[model samples]
Target: MGRIVAKVTVANPVDKSKSRTFDALVDTGASMLTLPTNWKKDLGDLAETRIAKVEFADQNIREIEICGPVSIQIEGFQKIFSEVAFLEMNTSDGMYEPLIGYIPLEQSGILVDMLGHRLKAAKYLDLK
Candidate 1:
């Protein structure tokens, strides 16, 4: 298996001035954009909030804070509208570990090149 990571910029749709760009893990298993709760505050005010039950890799299902209406842009890709999940995760090495889910990738028409460990823009989005 290979790891896919990319630099992602997340900004509140209402206020694009407040944004953050950093390296994030491309996780196909993740249902949506997941960021550390610490950064959520910097995004200013989001449009809405929701609670979702997420099953972690440990097999424990827990409720999570999901905030949204943000613009997600991967370097060299068009921005896409999507919600974000504020999660409680600790990085032992003191680094930001945001996870980019499949939703934004599909929405942006970007595909993960696991073999090349890069992102490829699709010529056409699938209807099926």
Candidate 2:
């Protein structure tokens, strides 16, 4: 499967004014919304940070900073409450690639439509 991308808005729950929208990658393999480390200050007033160990696709493991209780809104979907995992990541040309993962998508009842190459609203939420 190729890459799937989405437009996402991340905001401070209490202060919606502190929000930033980005062209985020749809990465189901990732556990939560991941943003560039720089975003923490942009989406300010975040809660204290905690550390989590991450294993990359290349099999490299590193500890990263995780923060937030930020609101996530993937275009065409309802907003969902979630945290942001900040990784010092960049593309080959030095561009940051923010990503929205499975947790937020499931929270908003959105399903990946990889066959159609777009996101679709889920028929029903899972409780099982």
Candidate 3:
């Protein structure tokens, strides 16, 4: 398997007018979208909050803050994620860019092509 990357846009659901575009790592190992703590201001005021326990590959666990609903755009699709975690770790700790995880990938109907190192839309069965 290879690393899948995509260009994504993150915005404040409350005010879509406020948003930022950037490249994000598409990580299936992650369950939720994660943005750098510095993006807090650009994401606008968070209306809700949650605590998430993140387990690293080394079996280390850490609790982090989650806030949303955030509007995320990928390719031509868009969805409002109810919660997004703000990574408090420093850039040196490998938290350099945003991460698009499984939740948003499934919600946005994005399919990962590992061999191609790209993302494609998941096809839905047309019952009609």
Which predicted model would earn the best lDDT?
Answer: 1
- Stretches > 4 Å off in candidate 1: none
lDDT of 2 by residue, 1-128 (tens): 77788999889999988999989889988888888887788887888569999998899998888887888889979888878899887678867888788888899998998898889999999889
lDDT, candidate 3, at 106: 83
- Show the colliding residue pairs in model 3: none
- Model 3: lowest-lDDT 10 consecutive positions: 119-128
Clash number for each model: 0, 0, 0
Q: What would you estimate as the lDDT of candidate 3?
A: 0.79
> What is candidate 3's lDDT per residue for 1-128, written digit by digit as tens?
66777888888877887888888888888888888888788777886587878897789898888987888887676565657888775767664767888888888878888878888777972335
Ranking by lDDT: 1, 2, 3
* Model 2 lDDT-worst window of ten: 89-98
Top candidate on TM-score is 1
Error of 3 at 77 (Å): 2.7
The best-first sequence of candidates by TM-score reads: 1, 2, 3
| Candidate 2 off by > 4 Å | 92-94
Residue pairs clashing in model 1 are none
| C-alpha-based local distance difference test score of model 2 | 0.87
**What overall lDDT goes with each candidate model?**
0.88, 0.87, 0.79
